[model samples]
Target: MRDLVAAFGGELPGCDTPGLLGWLDAFSDEHWNFRGRLGGAERDRVRVELPPRLAAAGLAAAAALGLAGSGEPAHREYTHLLILGGLARSCLQRADHAARLAGALRVGGIAALGSLRPLSAEERALPGLGRCRTEADALAAGVRAAFGGRAVPVLVAPPGDPAAHRANTADTYEFWAAGAHPGPGDRILVVTSPIYVPFQHCDAIRILGLRYRCGIDTVGFDPRLAHPPQPGGAAAADRCLQEIRSAIRAARALLAAVG
Candidate 1:
């Protein structure tokens, strides 16, 4: 896989520091302003602000690498690499989003998804977080139906693991079975968590590449300071960031090959 360390901003030693948020902030400053107003009473309305911010970040990063869309170049051509974060499982469970993404992709483009599976029935039976089960199941089923017979390449994490907890492995498998290959033309890369214990979705991509005979890549970054973190001292956040960077590099290489 091709490496794009510069695309991710700068490389730092050790994954301890919160780098993802730093990258996001740097990207936002160099690209566009990400503003959020707290006047809304509807929680959904407030929540809707996240996707745009993320899209902006992704777009900005692409731009920094000279991979973003632009009209100034007159006849500039570039492949669209769709990267979907593994949160809000609903986005993946519903086929509309996936179909829309597919439609937007050019013949030699790549659609990369980062997702997790729905909570199990047993997990859902618990209070508080239990409500998430229905949403997860619905999304999972929707995703399966959306690409049921399509020829989209997919990479996915295994079920019941932390990495696969919110990812749709079944959907990835279905797409792969439909003949999604990473070639000079359009393709899909469904990165999943590895089969090892304490699995993370990041591991899935590496494993899927080997299992399916597809070229693979990996990277990591820390996301804790940007979100919430666990109590006490643990290097989990650093490890995650390191893995993310590895994945990013791999993706860049794949893009270079296809471009």
Candidate 2:
């Protein structure tokens, strides 16, 4: 947290003010589990503050990603990052806002995403579903046209529900079937829950660790556990943090190679 604050090279909002970190820390301590640790009230606190913090950090990290690789300082005011959760509406909403900010980038600019899964056409049809689907599709299409190819090289991993996941996977397959190659510099990452693997053909897990040169780490917490619970939750969070760091490093390497 302190490192994040220092990265901004300025005071963080509510950082020095009394009870801010204390409140956030308290919330984290309370709701760190999944079963029943966090009740309605504590959950509300996380829903409110966590989004903004993640968005801010994601944007900054993305800019840093670009800068470290291309030496072209990111000029955009915002970065696009996506976050998707199995049943978390708040996470999706925050992701929607972040995607909007990222779309403001100029041509050749980067769109850094942190998503549970790529948006489906069904989700796109919903009112106010946001730009993840739209922008991603557009970018893919643009890359294809530029390369003059009949299809793009995409790897899909469908959801757990065989039928629904298959449908979604098929839709993406069809899209890519008609898409052109996305040039060397263009890239996309679609992250999903451990259980969801819609596309049976693609080794999504392997792609994360080897192909895209990155992987996601997750830590599960049961909310029913006691406050400041045993070592389980922290261990998970640590694993997640480590995996995220590894992914950042991998992404940086990819960007550098392209540059």
Candidate 3:
């Protein structure tokens, strides 16, 4: 963890877990959250040109933190399987992973949650989702393609402020939890890309797990196992850095909520 902190120009404070999370979040927000504005640009869409040493450090840190997919959940049964939405290709990849897990695990139901953010022209033209217009639509289409006619619930949340930003992970999780109302004994498994697992997992814990008193386990789609094969390069390292910043912020939120 300390190595990861140093990799991103952060210093791990000598403190308990909560204090460390707060420090990391503060540092990340000040130094690493690089988006121009709320929805004006996205973390993944940002083009990065990192120094070779920095890129290598970022990738190593990500792997140490399990941001490079664990490939399996901790348990074989879950009351709900939630696939978090993202970029067009990521939506399909994560949905495919979720479907594979659902087949082998005892899952009660499945839900793909996304925001109402409008899809870009490039995203709309993606295969298997040519007719889709929004992130939610992409996720729903992915589920359809991966599950092969299986009926799965798709939830979409309007942006908190349409003029500023798109609906985020918290909004989607809140929307689903409020509707599904999982019990204390139930467990939910969340699926997304490896880079996003840390932050999204923390978000799920803050919203669904804490509020509904249900267990939440978040995992990522293994890039090595992806059907079309996820491309690799320095860009992946940059994305991991972005998501590590995201995780720092979300961890702070989770700690505050726990308090």
What lDDT is reached at residue 193 by model 3?
83
| lDDT tens readout by residue for model 3, 24-87 | 7777666556564344376556666778877788788888887886557999899999998887
TM-scores, one per candidate: 0.29, 0.24, 0.90
**Model 2 whole-model lDDT (C-alpha atoms):** 0.31
Q: Supply candidate 3's per-residue lDDT for 190.
A: 94
Question: What is the number of backbone collisions in each predicted candidate, taken in the order shown?
Answer: 32, 20, 0
Better of 1 and 2 by lDDT: 1
lDDT of each: 0.34, 0.31, 0.81
Q: Rank the candidates by lDDT, best first.
A: 3, 1, 2
Q: Write the per-residue lDDT of candidate 1 for residues 115-195, one digit (tens) a residue.
A: 344455643543333345444343344344445665443244344445433434334433433344443332333221211
- The global Cα lDDT (0 to 1) of model 3 is 0.81
Query: What are the RMSDs of all candidates, in order?
Result: 14.0, 16.0, 2.3
- Model 1: number of clashes? 32
TM-score of 1: 0.29
lDDT of 2 by residue, 105-124 (tens): 33222221222344556445
Q: In model 2, what lDDT does residue 234 have?
A: 23
Better of 1 and 3 by TM-score: 3
Q: Which 10 consecutive residues of model 2 have the lowest summed lDDT?
A: 65-74
